[model samples]
Target: MKSPSLSTTAYAGASNGESSERPPFLRMRGLCKSFGHVTALSEVDLDLREGQVVALCGDNGAGKSTLVSMLSGVIEPDDGTIEVDGQPTYMTSPLRAQELGIATVYQNLALVEQRDVAANMFLGQEPVRLGVIVDRARMVDEATRVIQRLRVGLPSVRTLVGDLSGGQRQAVAVARAMLRGSRMLLMDEPTAALGVRESRRVIELIQEVRSEGQAVVVISHNMEDVFDVADRIVVFRLGRKIADEERAGLQREDLVSLLVHGCRSEEAGER
Candidate 1:
């Protein structure tokens, strides 16, 4: 498949409450997006802590895609700031995001159907040994080590991503991001099309990423997925943040109420 034309976003984020020792994974404030006269995202603010999983949820047209695009550098926000690793920086493109140790696994998975897992893992950025030849052996070894590091349960490194099961392909896609030395992953509905077991495996892989201390921004519509893995839940309603709850006291329905109705009144009362 043709890779999406990736570019870096021009806006840079902020650094707040982040330490000198620890890098600020990502920060955003007053993020806004519009096309013609239609506002897609407005005044959206987000902070991604290191090693934490943040679930970004909203109904369609609620600004999830716009935020992801800006974060992943698919499109620039009309207004906002973005900071990475404690430094204010602009993600001018997907490659620039990669340079900042940020990687995004889009909903489509972006695998080349004709290639094997190793090739897929190193797509666009292939390792070289003798000037122009790919470091085939090192690529395989590193790919193997990455899957092992993530505790991924793929049967073989030689498996073609296309031939693998849906969940396995998701694993490959995520693994590719990890192998590129990404410190954070912005996943877009990773389990949207997978079977139960496949989805479960993908969940486990995400856990492994967090265990390794890399922050994650997971965008999913599945409550189960959110409740199973998120450290924080940020719900958006009509281009605005309605609720930002820690996993400690937040319920699925409470977040749903904020997302679906933008009303808090007594979301906890239902429980």
Candidate 2:
């Protein structure tokens, strides 16, 4: 399997019909990371525009998680640079990533089972009144507003997070990230362990988020979900990026070939 040679300019001009004149909202250049002698990522470059939904697809150990970790500030790259909104930035920590308008929703969802939806939404940065106590009233009000804006159906903002269904819980997680003013969202298998109906709801949620003009990087193994929600597809293999192209002209089989053989079907025959 051969990794395609993709330059930043070539990626920007890919046939998505998006204007190449507009600069990407986020850019990663020559990102590399290694643990001891094992390289997790190598010279990977990616560009993302506002309101774009990019599906990161690959088999296990394909460096998808590693890349997401770097973007979320869970780890630092051994060599490379990250640019946000045309400014070079360092994601030193999770808090720094959030401050830089990046948020990550891991597979665990990270919601407290005992807490209500409003409480979980504003967990660490709960609103305070007069710098003395937690302002429950304001918290609920703001939570209600964000929930309504996202159109998430729930009994109430006061409903316990543990009581909500899987789909509803995923919505709450995304809503919480949005409330934090995050411009980019890194979601790890958001629809995993969900039923068909629940998965549909999550797909809708991703679409809604994209419509709100936030860039989304969805790490999903489900090909149907990728084709349904992604505007572009990025395939990683063996710690290298194998393919980066718009999703419009791509078929599921083509993506599968890339994931398995690291090349298109025709190219596979040549190899």
Candidate 3:
């Protein structure tokens, strides 16, 4: 793979008195979402800092996907606020979220099976030449550039996305996020169904993205993958945040229990 030329400043901490350009580029405070009588997310507060990888952990229905959906603009919260650089903002829609530089890579790896790598990355927004023609060269060049930005290991830009390995396909999906100049990325199980080596490659690529001054939020049930890449771990249970612990201060079972039952909040009133 060709190496990408980049600057160390790509992932620098915020110095303009804004919230540190550290991990977590976005934060939701007192966020709530409901459907009819049931609540999918309740008073949830989460953060996504630049250059930091946050692992969101929980059982199947712990509102993991729902919360991210709201953050990604697939859904809008009925209550609370979203803050970027400590300033409150509204996503209203996915396009608005993209304009805010927040991107989410869904679990299905939404690349068109019929499209090649370049085609997939530039799916609906292909670069146009002079007036009315597909700028194939520019499309491929930018596609290749973004792939390297994430340090993604791909066989070729011309390769069909469907033909790539599970990990490679995931890489392509992630590279698509860069096309929007995303500052924050939410990935739903990027390593799912991959062999050990392939999973490692994807994990490494994720690290590269984080190193490039971007924030990554990973939703995974795999504790091993979480430990392998996360700088901090956030556990959710029954649509509520249970714990937000740094990786060095916690263990696998501790995180697991927090996901299953929450890290026993001392707030007796909650209990």
Clashes of 1: 11
Q: Per-residue CA lDDT of candidate 3, range 1-271, in tens?
A: 1222123223332311234434335778899988888787899987777777788888887888888888788888989998887788888898888889888787898888778999999887888987779999998999988887677778779999878888888888888987778998889888877787787777787778887768888998777788777877788887788777777667766766566566643332433
Question: What TM-score does prediction 1 earn?
Answer: 0.88
Q: Candidate 1 residues 57-170, lDDT tens each?
A: 889988887888888888888888888766888878988888888889989999997888889999988899878999989889989999888777778788777788888889
Maximum-TM-score candidate: 2
Best candidate (score: lDDT) = 2
- TM-score (C-alpha) between model 2 and the true structure: 0.92
Off by over 4 Å in 3: 1-24, 264-271
Cα shift from native, residue 227, model 2 (Å): 0.5
lDDT, ranked from best to worst: 2, 1, 3
Off by over 4 Å in 1: 1-23, 265-271
> What TM-score would every model get versus the actual structure?
0.88, 0.92, 0.87
Report, for all candidates in order, the number of backbone clashes. 11, 0, 9
Clashing pairs in 3: 11-213, 14-21, 22-50, 23-49, 23-50, 24-48, 24-49, 25-48, 25-49
Cα lDDT of model 2 by residue, 1-271, tens digit: 0222222223324424655676787899999999899989999999988778899999999999999999999999999999998899898899999998898888999999899999999999998989979999988999999899888899899999999999999989999999999999999999987888888878878777877888899999988788777888999998898888787667778899999888888766522
lDDT of each: 0.79, 0.86, 0.78
